[model samples]
Target: MRILLIEDDDLIVESLTKALTEQHYVVDVATDGETGWELAEAFVYNLILLDVVLPKLDGFSLCQRLRSQGNQTPILLLTAQDTSTSKVTGLDAGADDYLAKPFDMSEWLARMRALLRRGGASLPPLLEWRNLQLDPSTCEVTCNGQPLHLPPKEYELLELLG
Candidate 1:
């Protein structure tokens, strides 16, 4: 699976990248909300891990904007704000799930798995055209039996136009 992590904290980014990659996921990192927005617009991902308080733009605005643009990618808010209001705001802004900071990693993983299962039902299993194949399950594409190491945006565009 491919996930976009939009967090500014170096420590959290490092840890999450390590954990997700260890699980055979492709982890793409964005340090700020604006960059996150750009990446989200450019790439295709199974999920987005968003942080609330961020530079350039806040998570709520970004989430709302993405939803307004009809981006249905699952977003999980991983922020320190654990209050009822914050949780409500996050959910209201279009996040599929919310995880308070200092959370149990196992629980987080479980939530991700649940979200993926729900989303998996909505998307096509795979896409293919001639010698090209796009596998959404693995976030991989191959042409003529050779892996095509295209960037996310290019890969997404190829999937759309193939």
Candidate 2:
């Protein structure tokens, strides 16, 4: 999964980036909302972890602008505010999910996975081509119920051919 992390706190950014990377996710960090919005517009991401308080532009406005441009990427807002109004505003501004500060990393990861699973955010874990099946997570390939001795590139090529 590819994630765009928009945060001004360096510690939070570093920690989340390292932790998410360890889980096999490609993470890009933007220190401010303007950069975050630009990057989000420029590339396709599996999820956007947006911080409400940011420099130049706020997360809420950025999300709204993104939605206005017809970008359907999932936005997960991370904020210190836990009020109902804040939640409502965030949701209204086009955030798909909201997580308050002092959150558990496990819960964040779980939520991210859930959001990705609910839509066309990331690639499927498995790919089937003709009579062959490839499991990307396990790096295993099978053809016609028989195991195939295939190199990684060769397997990918065959899968692409189909």
The models' CA-based lDDT, in order, is 0.88, 0.83
Task: State the lDDT of candidate 1 residue by residue for 7-83, as single tens digits.
Answer: 99999999999887655567899999999999999999889999999999999999999999999999999999999
Which has the greatest TM-score?
A: 2
Error of 2 at 52 (Å): 0.2
Shift in Å, residue 106, candidate 2? 0.9
- Which residues of candidate 2, in runs, are more than 4 Å off? 121-162
**Model 1 lDDT, full chain set:** 0.88
Q: If scored against the real structure, what TM-score would every candidate get?
A: 0.77, 0.78
Deviation in Å, model 2, residue 61 alpha carbon: 0.5
